[model samples]
Target chain A: MAIRKRKSFFDIINEYFGDVEELANQFEDMFMEKPSWSQKNCTMEPLKDVTVTPKEVIVTVDLPLAKEGTIEVKPLDSKTIEISAEMKRKIRFDDFGITHHKGEFQRFYCQTRIPVPVEMDKVKFNLKKGILEVHMPRKRGERIPIE
Target chain B: MSEITIIEKRNIAPDATMLFGFPDVGLVGVIAASHLIEELNLEEVAYVDSKLLPPLIVLHEGLPHSSLRVFANNNILLAVSEIPIAADIIYPIIQALIDWGKNKKAKMMISLSGIPIQERQDAKELKVFAAGSTPEMLKLAKEKGIDILGEGYMVGPQAVMLQKCANMKIPALTLLAQCFYNYPDPEAAAEVLKSLANITGVKVDIKALLEKGEEIRLKARDVMKRTQQELSGIKKAREYDIPLYVS
Candidate 1:
């Protein structure tokens, strides 16, 4: 008579890798070839746009399905302005063979540089079309300056 | 094999230089890599070959340039390269990197990446997150103000390297920026870059990153619209933990 024993995860892993290393290696190679770095698949933006006006540069960024007051902008260097926003969203996995659960996540950060340095005190921003816009005067000689 | 031509073959040198940058997750890695090659005048060391995989071109600047790759755009390298999420592929890829770094007498491995977090990115702050295998590495991460990941899974090349480095007992650290995932967020990249600059004292321009982000945002929006329509019936609306923030 033989006794049946329960198998543990460790035993299974050892048996699988020890005996089937070659098969595992081949299978692994296939996946290593796929690129997962591209932002093509995700529904988010890493940067926003701001149009430069004669008086000031109008910066715009998209933040759909988000309420106001989540984005903040600040001037860093003579030519740089920093922007950061936070939006919390819930993720549900009930549809994919997974039980219903709420998963919340926040997406944030970005920085922009003006063509020329601008006065930090003279910057203005607005959010429209799910886009945030900032207006700032162009710095003197920030444009085409005479040598 | 009949007349298989190997375009380039190279190896890591002693005290292998660790180049950190963001890849596709943001423009950081790609731009950083390109810039490092140009700034340091690094030569093409080797070209990684994997069908359907993006080119993994290694650049050597004099002697294993220990600088980060800056993108043509404003993005900086948050993580070094693309990471395959699947466990099967993840394990072996890490193994190869471990072996390569070891053979090169490398002391540690470094990677960079950015995550979309939900915070008004208007300020000069982009919450940075970090993870490492060794105690020393974690300490380094703390030294940099990068949040240490306690319990979670990162599904990219950086994640795979973390696991592999842990197994090999190699010191590794990954820096990630809180970024908006919906569009090419160069601003986020810039914030992350600032942190990297603080860590490495590397100066970079944000213009290229801004332009790249704008371009990526436009394209991604178009693709998302199409994908949403095409995948409507086939799959349920996939919700992501967007605008992610670290505690």
Candidate 2:
């Protein structure tokens, strides 16, 4: 009694290309060194973990000393995330018993690439105990029931 | 040529309890050892030298010092490494250290270290576990209310230390606190030190260490990064896998 909508030829081709693009992006991230800005100055690249599941991609960043309400998470594109946060106080080199380096750090900055295509508009984030967790749903085609 | 050589600068008591603090999960041992050195006012008594080691020297007060050094007072001899030890050298290096400890007639040996937990960040209270190389050491740990690590894969310098100590018949125990695998966890270090005090009667106030936890984490990032690199080469992920029970 019900009619099923068929996927068009162009839609199938687009899906195939999307998968290829994701695979290529993953390969690049695996082989290429990520571009980081920490070498220039006092900026630090916060340690992070990315776990991709069937439903969503979860990213957790360790941002110790990060102040509440000063953290920002922005999507550079559908496949990239930019995270920045201000530390509660400036940490001097002397603080760690290193007096030779006369510098201080007040911020944590990093740009992480997501391996899978994500629905950027639906990205959600939460910062707790100085750890930032970002969740984004995987981009997938509509599911159809098989008769 | 020996893979490692320990050059003694000062003679310590023959009945000393040697403590090993090598870089491992959470950098717990190194942090705990640094705290012990400062709090106990331990002096550099020996240094390890080897061509196999990467050309690295730590500077203190504008003076160059070996990356692997031993500190001691009257009753305690502490061996600590500023950098991570390469995997290929762990067995030989640990064997040498244990043999040297035996030559020194150390009564007992203990290694301060950490065990990684999946939800370390969410843990409200961290627990310290002990793995003893001998039954006497295990009994002592039980007497001190320290939980025994019933069975698990331990991968690092401490693992080799435990193995060598067992073969040499030296009483050794490895203390591990639940902690973040990649993060410098001073709080976990404090917990391990507390356990150390309980078992060995070597006491050091951990207030300053606890107060400066965040700053220590911030500064230890570079060392932690290097340690993470070495961790892969050492197959540290084995610590996370369930060990098979083979009779």
Candidate 3:
């Protein structure tokens, strides 16, 4: 007869946490689901990324073919910013050899949500080598004095 | 049945330089390989069949084609993968390709790829580095004035191919150009191609490639995202770590 040892307490706790992590990942995939572009908006969504550090939040967007003078970044709210840029030339599905889909996009558009609190007034941005980098200083709460 | 098989659609010439352009940082290999195919006018001679791959078939002009294929001309047999190969299947797939290439008596195998840099966008120029499967290959790269990637953790198909080729005593090399981690970089592709030309004397004009750079980036966005996910799964960032060499 084959015998199996019972799982220890730490093993049970690890397994439970693993399940929780998996569930969290599934939920994130579900909530983050959306098409990368919108034909109605006539805007192609450029790739963007966000990173948070102790001092600041840095957001970078890959804006290929973006005209230097036509780029704009506006704070929509405390935690959200809208970015848009006009491409040097309009792009069409036909440009990509797709005849079935008929649409032309002249701009890139997207909204990024900041995860942590940041100072909106102090936002600064620069465009270089076709990448737009936005820097915002993080907000730190006041320290409490202990008697 | 073998887990991975290379199916030839037509006769493949022996003694050819086998090149690999699997998806990696900045989609370097894919971009370079596409340009090579267009410039060299290479034809598809073979495709990879594997249960290890996902149930995905890329359609071109209403025709089904394997995501992984081998394009060839008189002197070059280029292996190109349209989709990123998952981490678990990388070893087997690369080993199979090495075995196939070896059987064909390939003179040398080279993998065109990229090394990610944090400040890639701001850099005015990109540099290409090389790693070799043998000492002679390293010496050859140096003779051509290419810098050697002396020691680092390279995670992906090219890394696997290099190790496998070394074990089987086949000459192999990997060329990595400095490039963006997340964005498709056609500029890096051009730099690596220049190195390829210098090393092998196989030249292709990069003017057309440079002209269509932005369009390539826009079209390559989805593939780059998928490749990034696969790269993360393979712990690709370990390549950036400075190793403690005991020897």
Candidate 4:
């Protein structure tokens, strides 16, 4: 049988903060209608997905045509991962059959926000088939004693 | 004016097999339909104009065109959309397309798409599954050695197509390949197309598609992002739920 225990004060506070942070992230997503590319920076945003499990938070970014050796992932903070990669070739707007907007993108860049608290220092990642997956184990919460 | 209309530029031949490929998971349909168009040299015969759609228009060869268009040759008439079909407009758009295809005396209708699978990245081989409008169509797919999509919720344009086609008594089937839900999957697209060929005997070279997989994924990122946004509005996550049909 599974043990049942009452929530502790720290647990309640953690849950509240998590919900608030998640809501704020949703709000940020709602009001932002920015394009995926930056003409000034010549950087194209790669598509990414984040999955939060009980054990870890896994973030995967699709980086097709990205130079494997040039891929970089840095922990921006406790909750964000910034990834950058150099593309094999410069992609010009003309290459997409658009000559009007003159710009050449030489790299892929994006930031992934993790929802749950995780150990950023113990992060592990690998690139396979041009897909980069970063795995960070979740930070353990305080345990409550069961009677 | 009707809310949606298919304006025909060239006369379409009757008894053609109508196919649908709209933006959905992994962009399976769009990618497969695009490849079909290129390999078959299908020409634009009709375009769907709708007030329900956004004001955006696709620019091709410096000429503006509808985002939703129909391309055809002698035996195949394909309906493809370059943009994501919003949740609200899905019903009318699909009904209109079905009506148009029926009017054209389309022999059969098939929708190419993808079904999301967990950990698709590690899978060594992908399988294509089919859901048909009627039992006979399902049996036909079984005879052709394609797995049947017997149960599970289907989301997006392909779902609408299957439901509408079933009600209209039109022979239709949806061929879905296992694919990543949020990423552009060219391999899944190719798998779906091979099943399409088995069913329709309309085959095309997939070598070029596989070779340019990276390039296609790179170019398709923006569209996939927008499609992902639209997908959530439709409660696409519900597809993962198990249904209980107890009365």
Best by TM-score: 4
Error of 1 at B93 (Å): 3.6
Residue-level lDDT of model 4, residues B18-123, one tens digit each, is 9999999999999999999999999999999989989999988878999999999989999999999999999999999999999999999999999999888888
Measured over the true interface residues after superposition, the C-alpha RMSD of each candidate is 9.5, 2.2, 1.1, 0.7
Candidate 3 docking band: acceptable
User: Residue B83 of model 3: what lDDT?
Assistant: 93
lDDT, residue A132, model 4: 93
Ranking by lDDT: 4, 3, 2, 1
* Least accurate 10 contiguous residues by lDDT in model 3 chain B: B221-230
Q: What is the lDDT of residue B86 in candidate 3?
A: 93
Better of 2 and 3 by TM-score: 3
Model 2, position A105: C-alpha lDDT score = 77
lDDT of model 4 at position A67: 89
TM-score of candidate 4's A chain against the true A chain: 0.79
Per-residue accuracy of model 2 over B9-52 as CA lDDT, tens digit each = 88768999999999888999999999999999999999889887
The per-residue C-alpha lDDT of model 2 at residue A141 equals 78
> What's model 1's lDDT at A15?
76
Ranking by TM-score: 4, 3, 2, 1
Chain B TM-score for the candidates in order: 0.62, 0.98, 0.98, 0.99
Our tally of clashes for model 1 stands at 79
TM-scores of the candidates in the order shown: 0.46, 0.88, 0.90, 0.92
CAPRI grade, predicted model 4: medium
How many angstroms is residue B64 displaced in model 3 relative to the true structure, after the best TM-score fit? 0.9
Better of 2 and 4 by TM-score: 4
- DockQ for all models: 0.06, 0.38, 0.49, 0.65
